[model samples]
Target: MRRSAVLGGRYVLRSLIGQGGTAEVYCACDRVLEREVAVKLLRQASVEERDRARFADEARLLGRLSHPGLVTVLDAATSDEEPYLVMELVHGPSLADCCRGVALATTRVAAIGAQLAEALRYAHDNGIVHRDVKPANVLLAEDDRALLTDFGIARLLSASTGHTATGTAVGTAAYIAPEQVRGEPVSPATDVYSLGLVLLEALTGERAYDGSPAEAALARLTTPPPMPSTLPAGWRDLLLAMTALDPADRPTTVEAVDSLRRLAAETEPAKPGFTGRTDVGESPATRSTAGSLPGSAVVTAAAGQLRTTGLGAVSRPAGLARRAGLAWRWATAAVLALVLVLGVTLWSNTLSGRPPQRDTPAGVPDRVQKPLQDLHDAVEGDR
Candidate 1:
């Protein structure tokens, strides 16, 4: 029989929300505060000496981070025979749930992706790498907020805990980086790669490399992705840079983040009802809505250029298997291109008889609106 709840002095577990390889997260109530919190309990069977240390490490990690888009750690402790972390309860859907039902608008996806990048930059700067980043870990909070969760498999620079064969594979296979597969020491670049896959899933409304976990992992080593033409043009090179087979070949996470920010800037004038900070070469109306993501995470300039190095400087480890992986990418790309061509041809035929419809609204002018209302004004005044 399973216990329905863990009744503690300060907190009471309501039900389990998620169970991973090492930890099980529960929805709990803080008896003192009378508020809900997520209590992540480390599975006793999974708690090795290193895992216990890692559990303790999360408190220190969360202490260093303060961001609106990140899930905050409220408290941590070990009780009876369980180690638990109390966290902010994010009440909303997962990115995976969103993707399964709806293809996110490009701007919305960019907004979410940008926020995630900002969080990653902050973590990387603080010498932490969120080794496992995936859709399930991202929460769409109420009031249209995008929050990142689940730092259980995160790696801290000062810790000896790592997924180097002796440990279980850390990340979801679909989002794992190439270097991680080879058992090489990981850096911020690995996070960039995983985030790239997140962005890829965001855009395509499908997995970038899909199949069994084993097949997907094999594909990552050998798959040269088809050209960016299939993706919204804005995301092409950024994805290529992040998903490059060689860890050295991939752009630094900070650079990739900057590229995303710039792309968002270019998109500002085109999005309707935007009013944020404006920069040079942009209209003041657009300025108020540009780069002014309130409560959005920030990447300090120095950290943005941390370990400045160009892609292609770091070489993929030399091995027959890696070379074969490279060759496999070319082959996979060819197949992908062929499939793309066929799909386009079929899609063209479906719409061949109908006239093209304009994307802009019919009655409204085709121009960006100087949003008379801001988020704060709308939420506060109206309510």
Candidate 2:
């Protein structure tokens, strides 16, 4: 109802598909290229130079990033009152939609993580940090290929990426890194943390941390989530390393790619012509859901529009902000818990007139901490 047509002869608009704060995406057919495409139009009134500059900058940035998992930017133009971008139209469901009460098979989730990590690595090498890397930003193709979308909130590695005019936090709250929440300059690690969260959600069907907005912000900044071992062993180390509270402690993109590959290999069989589906027949509850398909639905031909499902539907801006705040609070609580445990241990030792044990002799290891030492050596060696 906002506007009828857009971009004139460049692309024929079919219908509005989505609307955001400053943009509206439409399903359109590219006349020149003769292909179905998604056209995103900037909705902000261009009364200020900064808005125009940022809009143009995003288009330019997207044009530079070329990857199979990333959404392809085909054309950019300004029409009537807004800027427009024509991009590849993809069909499938978002990770959020599929993330409701449903837990994806471990292999499928790892496959998605691997694809997205590769995309992030490519972007980082190109000096682009996808500030926003959440479920909604990821498109699961009909064939289950992971495709990243919505680079609108992406930050260039150089210069002041983007910020609220009134000095408020930008970027998606739940997915935003601690540095971003603290108004610090964002780095590739910021995206790494976000991607880690995505992997966690895909595996556990639960966010790492959740609470009100202030609490969530504090949580991400102060506390690290429990180890992935709390969920499953295959991906525990990988997720733990990726979500390390200290950016320096997180694994590099290459490491992430390797880890995810291992996880995928363990869960999914390696066959010459496997398309990520085994074609197992439906069980008893195939038609339980009125408007859904059976569990045994195989991945054959590409599906249609990405249906809204599960966590993806929880993307309300206000709720997102509140959730982020809540996560910060949970993080704070985690910090307090760690401190209390340390305090209790120290107090108990003090009462018993015993001092905390120091490291064993440099070359000779103590038998008590031998296993601990070995673990330390393995982790350090891996690094």
Best by TM-score: 2
**Window of ten residues with lowest summed lDDT in model 1:** 285-294
User: Model 2 residue 284 lDDT?
Assistant: 15
Report lDDT per candidate.
0.56, 0.58
Candidate 1 regions exceeding 4 Å error are 1-8, 44-51, 158-169, 265-383
Model 1, span 49-119: residue lDDT tens = 55676677666677578888788888877533567778888777677666642345666777788788888
Model 2 poorest ten-residue lDDT run: 285-294
What TM-score would you give candidate 1 relative to the actual structure?
0.64
- True lDDT of residue 231, candidate 2: 44
Q: 302 in model 2: Cα distance from truth in Å?
A: 48
